[model samples]
Target chain A: MIDFENVKLKIGDTEITIGAVLESNGSTSNLKTGAWRSMRPVTDLEKCISCGICWSLCPEGCIIKRKDGKFEADLDYCKGCGICANECPVKAITMVMEEK
Target chain B: MAIAGLPEEEYLSCGHRACAGCGAATAIRLITKAAGKNSILVESTGCIEVISTPYPETAWKLPWIHGAFENPSSIASGISAALKAKGIEDEINVVAFGGDGSTYDIGLGHISGAFERGDNFTYICYDNEAYMNTGIQRSGATPYGASTTTSPAGRESIGKVEWKKDIIHILAAHKSPYLASASIGYPTDAFKKIRKAIETKGPTFVNLFATCPTGWRSDPAKSIELAKLAVETGVVPLYEIINGKHVVGMPRDISKLKPVEEYLKVQGRYRHLFRPEKKEMEINFIQERVKENLALLLEYAETGH
Candidate 1:
């Protein structure tokens, strides 16, 4: 029998399980997909309404409601698809080019 | 307060490899929310499967399993049977999901068998209209006149000549208790249908019209708008078939459908139809077909068939 606890292997700072089985759920959050963004979304809190359109429509589910009741995307995981800006009713979000 | 009445709990976490603004990802988020915590998801080999699970990492918060490209429904059936054996079949939800490549073509037989047996599960097909994961090859779900790598519209040929397969009608033929067609554009409606499908006993099916901006060559931000246009143009009607009775959902009036051109012009797949000279004949054909399909659905709804 294979010992579950002793078979850990490390790959580039991240530990990989032996059989491609992840013991923890939703571990993909560790991957920062924001690196794929060529554009970044900027939300205008002054004009923003907490309609949750951005939160509901976000493909990554990266948008979170801040303490002020306005929702903004977590840039660490946001890929900058611009759907939030496009679907924003009040035009509260705008897509800007990512800086090098 | 509840984020448009949807549960605040998220089952599909952030940071996956799906393209930015993927409609399937949006649909999946809503789906997992509806399925809640006590659920098992069976995934067919497709884009979501590849993107969500990248060896020792998974985006799914629920118990999930991936079978081959053509056997998600079969796996779901087995899972349902196991649940039944365990005597907790009614306590958990079993949801099988796949892309158009698997649902419309490769795994059609397996799905048919599962539906025939009245397995207690829900099968959701996120229809992006092509084999997007494998480089945009045409599938049975690919609508007519849409160009793909395999069905290119060139000097001599117009895109895919065949009409999209009426998958809902086929599934309804099995006398399944519930069958519905939804679109990511209408998240609330889609969520309701998903919850209802999961709550229903026996086999239920939901055809979710998801958009593929990468495959369709459409602007990424316009995915939801394109899906909305598809429904408005009568190209993808949102409706439910309950016990063989048609319950038409949106765009009930025949006069309300926007011209098919409005829907086609935004996507690069149909660019050939307009550029290098407009193909009026092809455009008219698509328009007529859309009307006829919606009219048929209206008749079914009226006749209680």
Candidate 2:
């Protein structure tokens, strides 16, 4: 058996393995890249319509839909490419400095 | 419930070695999302392969194999044959992917052979318009007037004097069950074409117009926008040729197409064209070429010739 503990992952209750999981879903899901962000996107819940423009166009695949259907940045893998902010059809996403 | 627009699975990982805004990676991601896990991939030497698979660590989750630049199609055919011999050909998709160098140039003979043999595989060319992995040399697929390293634009010349090779017509000439051209900007269309190409039992071909920010000398942020511009301006018309008949996908009305300048402006490779005096003649030539190309496709659609 392989020592998966040596590998980084946030399994979230799925039986996934090295060969089967292949190269996506944040690659190393447990590693949060939030520190890589110099700026972050702030979504106005009221001003935003859940058109999902940000969810699909994100290069990092970091923008995810919450249970309520509104989208938010995972920040874990979002290199803060700002592609979501640029692609947001309604201008609902704005980029701000990562103060924290 | 599925996330409305976001793809559910990630065949391409966030940590892959592609450039920050690599459009070819976007196309690769989208294509893998469509192909699903039951697929085995055959990749030729190209940017996608070099960057994704670095030694022991690989970026692919599928049963993928790397082949020489000129033999991905041959390898795919062998895989398909082995699967058929085992009576499991129907359950798996053998997809061969490469850059324009491999698809339109180096691997053309093998591609033709595979298609002629009616191999059960899909060949996808991630066309960034030049041999980008080999330092942006001009490939057969590079459009006219683009300044690649081998085809530099200077006082003696404007740029590549030859027009873009008509690979689509060549594939269509084989009476391929399915053949289409798509861009990374239009994921919906790209996804559909990828799915269709894989699902079709016989040979299929898809040329995905991938934008290369490094090779094209364009802003990484503008990659998708440039891809969108290519289709919107009819410079890279998105369409499917099925059973020897052509069908237009986007910009159905040719009149709505924007000028070539709109598509050329963002790319650094075409920057010199807009200098002080401007390469008015070349720009006009490109515009006319786009028109004639579309007109010929339209005519072919009507006449079936």
Candidate 3:
């Protein structure tokens, strides 16, 4: 049997192990197992003018710069502020809101 | 003793001040109702504090404390910390409320710090766009091209040159226990979100869009109407950023939503945007931005979490 202590969050229908929980309430006097929201980036390459506006404005610095200078967001760390989409002059970078 | 819903008792008495059809007042009333009588209100120096309390008196029926313009979250954090230290954590729910100016502008760092520290409190930002308490000045949360006391419509410029700050996502990055966005137009959703914030263990931040008739130069009665328009027009999509995921609760048909012009024309702040003589490119630019936002939100909903 899988150890309950070792068990982590299972995501999607496949239940892919994304990341282990570093700290669970751990008998803390007041803390509890918290819930989190996942944010994904959706870029329409056709509409994208390669303006790099999204790259410059990302607060989390999750947007990745390629060898070709084409901008793409790092899905793992992107918090989905929608600033990239909001600041995009050509309206290319958009936030894909993931439901709980 | 219903934990799932707001209390029926009115904690914010309707006596002292607040302008005619103040959205901040509605936010105060709604928030107090959700938090119940066993709650302490931490207010910043803005429209809510200025209008509700005139030094000698207050309109609040529950326990309330006023803080500086940029330190309501910190003040609330202190209150929560004190409660924990005194071992009376369950006796009262601590809530810090502020206007867009205090929240998205001067108080962002404080709000972020409180969240990062995992302060046990419910933080609500009643966003009415501009700094209404300070003569309708432009705030960081103000939308692009909207006229304010500071960003006036002139031959040189349209209005505010910046876009609204998304504090919910910022708080989400802190990995706070709970985070969400709500609006006065969606009372049931707003009530649910705030109730969740109160019941949660760690820090909870909710960004509420409050319609300001005085600030935005709109009809007082159109507060709720404009509020609904904000959600529909994608100017402010209704969503929750819990933990780290972004979720838009209301994903109705975009075709049913009124045009950007319909929402813009009613508010005098955006009158310059609708000018017939303006270059077609600038107007088209605004239109494209709105459409792109709507499309992005809808697409996000499709790829289910």
Candidate whose DockQ is highest: 1
**Candidates 1 and 3: which is better by TM-score?**
1
TM-score of chain B of each: 0.99, 0.97, 0.92
Decide which is better by TM-score, 2 or 3. 2
* Predicted complex 1: CAPRI docking category: medium
Off by over 4 Å in 3: A1-100, B1-6, B276-280, B298-305
**Candidate 2: segments with Cα more than 4 A from true spot:** A1-42, A95-100, B1-7
- lDDT tens digits, residue span B104-138, model 1: 99999999999999999999999999999889999
Name the lDDT value of residue B225 in candidate 2: 81
Candidate 2 clashing pairs, residues 3+ apart or interchain? A22-B61, A23-B13, A24-B13
Per-residue C-alpha lDDT of model 3 across residues B41-96, encoded as one tens digit per residue:
89898988776565434566677777888999999999999999999988889999
Residue ranges of candidate 1 with Cα displaced over 4 Å: A1-19
Candidates in order have lDDT scores of 0.93, 0.81, 0.71
TM-score of predicted structure 2, chain A: 0.68
Q: Global CA lDDT of candidate 1, please?
A: 0.93
Model 2, DockQ value? 0.18
lDDT (0-100) at residue B128 of candidate 1?
Answer: 97
